[model samples]
Target: MGWIGETVDSIKSLQIRQVLTQTVSLGMIVTSALIIWKALMCITGSESPVVVVLSGSMEPGFKRGDILFLHMSTDPIRAGEIVVFNVDGREIPIVHRVIKVHERQDTGEVDVLTKGDNNYGDDRLLYAQGQLWLQRHHIMGRAVGFLPYVGWVTIIMTEKPIIKYILIGALGLLVVTSKE
Candidate 1:
């Protein structure tokens, strides 16, 4: 009877130890991911260091479902360069090429005109009402690097909410059931 009681107590202790260990390991993984993202933001000097191409606007050069790496530099924005920018009252960002650059004589500030590679005309129609050009503040960053077709995963998950839910559930189950 004493031997049986000792065996049960040891089993319970080992189970508790395993649970605590897994919990701590999971916490560390989440924290590490966040640290890496924040570090990228700082290194790139952009709020979002990574962006997914959603449309074929810049097709032939940048296709839909491609992943773009962005960087914000102190150097002036120039024409013929691809840039991502946000328009007033708009939530989604636009990716296009700078077609023209207008420099001010009084304030020395610059305004940029952008157009998609495949589009018929400039982006002035897409801009906010009464806005003709994109200011520096509206620009997020310029494309520095890219990975082809890598952004499809994010696009699918965004377009299909059910798949995202299932994937999240599976990952949660995997973590809970992992023995190692």
Candidate 2:
């Protein structure tokens, strides 16, 4: 009991000023990241301003590990626009190009069909089971630009469990041990 208290007291009393300085520095770094993410959301007009391609569904045009920039506009979604969408029960989002659009006059709503560039058929299988078409609500954003092979780091980390852990551990260690 005496040794534990003495040890803790030594640590807590020593380097108190330096510890607070590093702690505040780390907080600023984390806050800066959040601010940058929010700024991207505002500037791109998309909830997810950037996305990493996880599958090769959109090959030739976009391969796995490619990074895409998205922008949402009030204009109606048009055929040929590559968009990211979410379906009920799916954990990950899907990126595909719009193939068809059915506009309803009564409600002014749009029903869309999407297809992958490398796929043999439209994205019927990717949609919610038994659901025929994707409504505007499923769409997250439209692809405005892309950077090829940039997201391989994310893909590799996802594919290899240990790499993900190591990367995360390294980041945590860096944050914890960094002086500034």
Candidate 2 residues 3-56, lDDT tens each? 999978866765777777777877898899999999999998899999999888
Please give the lDDT score at residue 65 for candidate 2: 87
Residue 94's lDDT within candidate 2 is 95
Model 1 lDDT-worst window of ten = 8-17
TM-score (all chains, Cα) for each model: 0.90, 0.84
Best by TM-score: 1
Tell me how candidate 2 scores on lDDT.
0.90
Clashing pairs in 1: none
lDDT per residue as tens, model 1, 1-180? 999999778657668778788888878888999999999999999999999999899999889999999999988899999999999999999999999999888987889999999999999899999899899999999999989999999999999999999998998767755778
- Worst lDDT run of 10 residues, candidate 2, spans 171-180
